[model samples]
Target: MIKLTEINKIYRTNEIETVALENVNLEVEKGEFLSIMGPSGCGKSTLLNIIGLLDAPTSGIIEIGGTRTDGMKDKQLAAFRNKKLGFVFQSFHLINSLNVLDNVELPLLYRKVSAKERRHLAEEVLAKVGLSHRMRHMPTQLSGGQCQRVAIARAIIGNPEIILADEPTGNLDSKMGAEVMELLHQLNKEDGRTIVMVTHNEEQAKQTSRTVRFFDGRQVE
Candidate 1:
């Protein structure tokens, strides 16, 4: 479902150059839940970003669901990403000013979806994530786990084919983290959504369909 060939990401300045990923080639099958495990400074998040079309590699080819993305223009990329990808960050990127339901409805605003349809879809995903009761709550009013659940609802509200989650449970306690992991597994198993998650938790990585480890910007396992 996703493929990266000899991907290389580098940050260049007039005096210095840093490599975030080097000659990394990886693939994830459709409906597979893959975990990326690595130490800090490794290229896990960088790889996830490239796969999600949020960032471009300095060199390499990326293909998602059989479409090559190497030469897509900015407009084309935006359209494609909006339709095919969903993202959940370590820090829930909710709009603080918007209530839970409104935050979950943000992604649909990019498409031509009507307000009525958007609200309905948002409500459905929130129910799926067990956040239906928190729809009217503010981010400040919810626990860390609730915030992340809302983020997941927001990510899936559009029904994207792939979900890119970066340290999804990093900020929560064990119980809450477990709850979130169970929800992610349900999404993958029941909904058949392909998930690629970056995580430092070994136990969490163990539960995924496959785990790939990275070190010093390269795939080590």
Candidate 2:
């Protein structure tokens, strides 16, 4: 459902130029679960950001669900991203002041969904993540695993077609990391959501349907 052709990303400073991605071409089919694994400075996160439309590529094209995103305006890209993508990060990225339910409902709020509908959707996702009872808890009140579960719920609350996770288990213990990975697998296998996860763990990458290795901004076989 996602296609990248000759994707190139460059970072320029007054004295230096850094190439984050070099003519990267890849395709992820609908309902596929793909893991990107690499060492530090491999551009995995940069590629993920490009796929999520959080950053623009210096050249090449990206098509999401068949629409070309390369030439879209910022507002158009933002709207498209909101409607088509969900993100889960290692940091959880939850607002400290917001309760679990409110954090989960935040995406729907941007979509202008009605309050009743957003609450219902958010609550349903929270229940799926076994967080219904903790809906009113703040981020500080939850353990790392619980907080990650809340983040996962928030990511899926909008029913976005693709989930982009960057080092999702980086901050958790092995057990908690496994739990998070299991949840992501369940979403991919049962819910039929496409997932592109960037991680440094070999065992974690092995659990995914397919794994792509990267080195110094280039994909390795």
Candidate 3:
């Protein structure tokens, strides 16, 4: 579960101050698939980044699975994030040079896990995402949907409890997008992973367990 109270994210420069999130409060229950819907510049992705602890809120409290993150040091935050959260992005964030198996194993390199164990875990998750046959392929060799699947495999290989996805299907065709959504739904329903996704698709939002709408950095619904 995740909780955010009075969350505000502001970017300030010499003569300009922009509020990305304004006193936004949110709560995501365990095993819930939540969608955040909004137009561009409405802070949907900013909110997601804040919740994922990749960015800090200007003034607010963030609690994930009962642990308060506002006060955690950088090293502590990194360690906690590595263990408790997974991230998926529209851009796929895959290293072009690394093959599927190696990319999926990147997260484990930060931990004390051995190479053999990392490969085993990567293989298992790649299989879960139906990418077992493509493990040796490079990012340039895969389709958009396949790239996303590889990204998903990388995200889950650590078995993180929370998945934060931002515009996960933005770059794919409808068919590919649907396939990715099906995979996400399976992870949410069958694996019981908590997912908080930011999307612009109305139908996709409707499919989630709950949806929250935002406008001008404020949660409107």
Candidate 4:
């Protein structure tokens, strides 16, 4: 479902250049739950951002769900992301003033859905993530786990084809992390959504369909 060829991401300052991903090549097939395991500064998150179209690689080709994204214009990229990609970050990234329902419905606002339809879809996904009761509460009103669940609700509300999670469990306790992982597993195994996760936890990586390790910006395994 996703393919990257000779991907390289480099950052430049006035007099220095740093490479984040060097000659990185990878793929994730449809219906696969892939975990990226890497130490700090290994380009795992960089790779994920490129795949999700949140960032462009310095050079390389990226094809996601059969669409080439290397040269997509900004407007086209936004539309593509709205239709196909969902993101879950370690931080909840919710708008504190928006409340749960509005936060979840934010993604749909970019589309042409009516207000009623947007609310209905948001409610359904919030319920799916076990947050229906907290829909009216603000982000500050929820616990970390609840906030992440709300974030998950927001991510999936658009019915995205691919979910990219970066350290999804990094900030939660083991029990809460397990809960999130179980939810993600259901999305992958039951809903048949493709998942590519960047995680530092070995056990968590082991639970995925496959694990690919990275170090020094290179895939070592």
User: Global CA lDDT of candidate 2, please?
Assistant: 0.90
> Per-residue lDDT of 110-131 in model 1, one digit per residue for the tens?
8899999999999999999998
Give each model's whole-structure lDDT.
Answer: 0.90, 0.90, 0.92, 0.89
Better of 1 and 3 by lDDT: 3
Greater-lDDT candidate between 3 and 4 = 3
The alpha-carbon lDDT assigned to residue 62 of candidate 2 equals 95
Q: Taking the candidates one at a time, how many backbone clashes does each contain?
A: 0, 0, 0, 0
Q: What TM-score, to 2 decimals, does candidate 2 have?
A: 0.96
- Decreasing lDDT order of the candidates: 3, 1, 2, 4
Off by over 4 Å in 2: 212-215
Best by lDDT: 3
Q: lDDT per residue, candidate 4, 1-221, as tens digits? A: 99998999998998899899999888889988888888888888888999999999999999999889977899999999989999999998999989899999999998999999999999899989998889899999888889999999999999998999999999999989988998998889889999999888989778755545654586635
**What TM-score do all the candidates reach, one by one?**
0.96, 0.96, 0.97, 0.96
Candidate 3, after superposition: displacement of residue 123 in Å?
0.4
Candidate 3 minimal-lDDT segment of 10 residues: 207-216
